[model samples]
Target: MLLKSIRYSLDELIYLLNQLSDKGYSKSCESLGNETIGEHTRHIIEMFQCLENSYDLGILNYGNRERNDQIETEIEFAKQCVVEIRTGLKSENKILYLEHVIGGLAIRIQSSYYRELLYNLENCIHHQTLIKVAVLKFQNIAVIENSGIADSTSEYRN
Candidate 1:
């Protein structure tokens, strides 16, 4: 159920990537506080990568992501990364610990894989919303309807 939505969200990104150029991918958007679309895309991919990379350890620390630059600088690489994320996203739900350092304090919380997956889905959509704006403003492109919108919001609007 959730995986389907996650796939759909990733597919939305793939579609957008088809229309984006390398320059557009890395171009800074004045509307988004000079942040580039690639930066946001990198963020979206890394969060999921952090989850997948640490799954075997039964612990997750999102802050420990690689912050890989290739995914953000190259549009083709970003597309490939998104496809890899879609292909790699398969796991049975299990109890996991979420470790995070907040304001010099480190903490761990018990969380399930499905819960974290849901969080990642939400995080992806949040970034997509911003990406949609940048896409529109940067290139005057028409984003797929509801691509960046929450499912509930899309339902409500209809």
Candidate 2:
């Protein structure tokens, strides 16, 4: 059920990307405090990439996530990243350690893969909401349905 929700969100993002040019994808949004859509896209993808990379290691460290500029500037690469995440997610839940670095110290907390995935799902929704606002500014792009809404909220509306 969680995977389905994540995939649905990812599909919505991809559909939105399909409607944009590289310039439009990377253009900074005034509403987002001048942050570009590509930046938000990269941040969302990198969080999932961090989770996927850390799964085998049994330790999750989002602080060590890669900030790839290409993922922000290149729409096709960004789309490829979303596709990779969509395909790479597994259904098997497992015990994991979330590593947080604070004041030069590493704090390890017990967590599950599913929990982290849920966090990533919410992260995607929040960023997509901002992305939706930015995309809306472009008069050329059509509205993307449910591109940024939360599942529970959507259910409530229905």
Candidate 3:
């Protein structure tokens, strides 16, 4: 059930990205210090990518994100990355270690792949909210109802 929810959130993002025009996808928002929607999308996708890439290593470090620029410039490329991530997320759950560096100190915490997948799902929804704002303000496009909203929020609305 959890994995299915994560996949659904990712698919929702892909649907929203497909609706964006090239100009809309690449346009920077002055309110966001001229950061493009594509950049936000790239960041979100990279989070998932980081998890997938480090799954085999048993150590997850979010600071090691790929930050691929191609994903920021090309909608199709981002979509492909999503497909790869979805496939990676389907693997059996396993225990993993999360490494975080704070104030010059390294902290290691035990975690599971399922938990990280949930984190990525929530992270994508938050970023998609920003992307939805850009789509509305710059492109005047209406996002599919509840496309980027969390299920709890959507349920409250109904």
Candidate 3: tens digits of C-alpha lDDT, residues 73-104: 88999899989888777568999899999999
**TM-score of candidate 1 on Cα atoms, chains taken together:** 0.95
Worst 10 residues of 2 by lDDT: 138-147
lDDT of 1 by residue, 20-95 (tens): 8898889889978999999999999999989988788999999999998898889888888899999998669988
lDDT of each: 0.91, 0.93, 0.85
TM-score of each: 0.95, 0.97, 0.91
Locate the minimum summed-lDDT window of 10 residues in model 3.
133-142
Weakest 10 consecutive residues of candidate 1 by summed lDDT: 133-142
Candidate 2 per-residue lDDT, tens place, 35-55, comes to 999999999999999999999
Give the Cα-based TM-score of candidate 3 against the true structure.
Answer: 0.91
- In model 1, what lDDT does residue 44 have? 96
Report lDDT (Cα) of residue 66, candidate 3.
82
Model 3: pairs clashing at backbone N, Cα or C within 3 Å: none
Residue-level error in angstroms, candidate 3, position 137: 2.0
Candidate 1 wrong stretches, greater than 4 Å: none
